[model samples]
Target: MKFKVMAFLVAMAAAVPAFAQQAGPTTDLAKLEGGVFTVDKGHAKILFSYSHFGYSTSYGLFTDFDAKLTFDPKAPTSSTLEATINLDGIETMVAKLNEHLKTPDFFDTAKFPSASFKSTKITVISPTTGTVTGDLTLHGVTKPVTLDVTFNGGGTNMAKKYDLGFNATGHVKRSDFGLGAYVPMVGDDIALTISAEFNRVQ
Candidate 1:
């Protein structure tokens, strides 16, 4: 009887880790309702890079962008994101460069005040990783893009608020959307990077 008791205790001890693992990370949203979350714009960044002179890379950022995340982390595949970026808010170190970027030769901010993205599908690739396939609209042209996304981490903030972190990346072609005015001078591919923080609404 003592031997059987010892065996049962050992089995119970071994089951502890498995139970904790099943509990998963504390922020598992799948068990919760998918509600609206506000993007912490102050902690959000939308940056892009393009080849300069076919040799070097130049980077720029949009100072104004808004995003809404409707997420259920436990069921990552059901998550969706909608984001809008003001093209007129593109900022660069050089004032003249920023001005030129908004002209018809580039973004044509006068014609297209904003760019937007809406995810059509979200596929959970792993426990903390996923891909969002969506349509990105820029300068009146829409094209499909896939954002490789990963959940960074989330927890209660110092303000006693629940928050989430994410990083995503994708690429776009200038020519495909009719922003081909720069041609070989500015390189065709533009790399996009997004780092955003979201605060739970409730």
Candidate 2:
């Protein structure tokens, strides 16, 4: 038993260095690859929340989404992005609520089907932070919105692909998009948060 324990400990010690050598994304812009990248859907998510009658906050998210990013290392402000979210993919973790959200009272997935955003401007505030102004189309209405974005990191992943990660937050008036169902009772202002990872495709 002593010999077996010793062998296991030795093997575990040897693996530590290997694990340490494996690199993930980093917060270094100089190392980021400049090109077109596609969202790594498996590593990305879009979440939204709103006040519920001032009692609590209700949260939900869209699971099926895709985005394409155009990055320029030399001129970061020139970067742009386009994304689409399937309205039918909304999830609140409650089966009935999820189905209700798809009804006309809320998103009305049958009519809109999807929401999309196309960035019109990218402003670099610093090495790792910026703002993105874009046209957001949701619930059959289009409006301009700006999102505060942070460049979380960039690096080459284990798959040998250049990966970049970002976090963005924004707010929109639900009524502006014709999504006002409960109004003040459910809240008209909606907050959106997005965390995504993009893998270089070009």
As for candidate 2, its clashing pairs are none
RMSD of every candidate to native, in Å, equals 10.4, 1.6
Q: Taking the tens digit of each residue's C-alpha lDDT, what string does model 2 give over 3-62?
A: 999999999999899777758766666776789999999999899999999999999999
Using all chains and alpha carbons, the TM-scores for the candidates as numbered come to 0.82, 0.93
Candidate 1 wrongly placed segments (more than 4 Å): 1-34
lDDT of 1 by residue, 83-128 (tens): 9999888987789999999999888999899999999999877766
Clashes of 1: 1
Model 2 lowest lDDT segment of ten: 24-33
Model 2 sits at a Cα RMSD from the real structure of 1.6
Model 1 lowest lDDT segment of ten: 23-32
Report the error of model 1 at residue 11, Å.
47
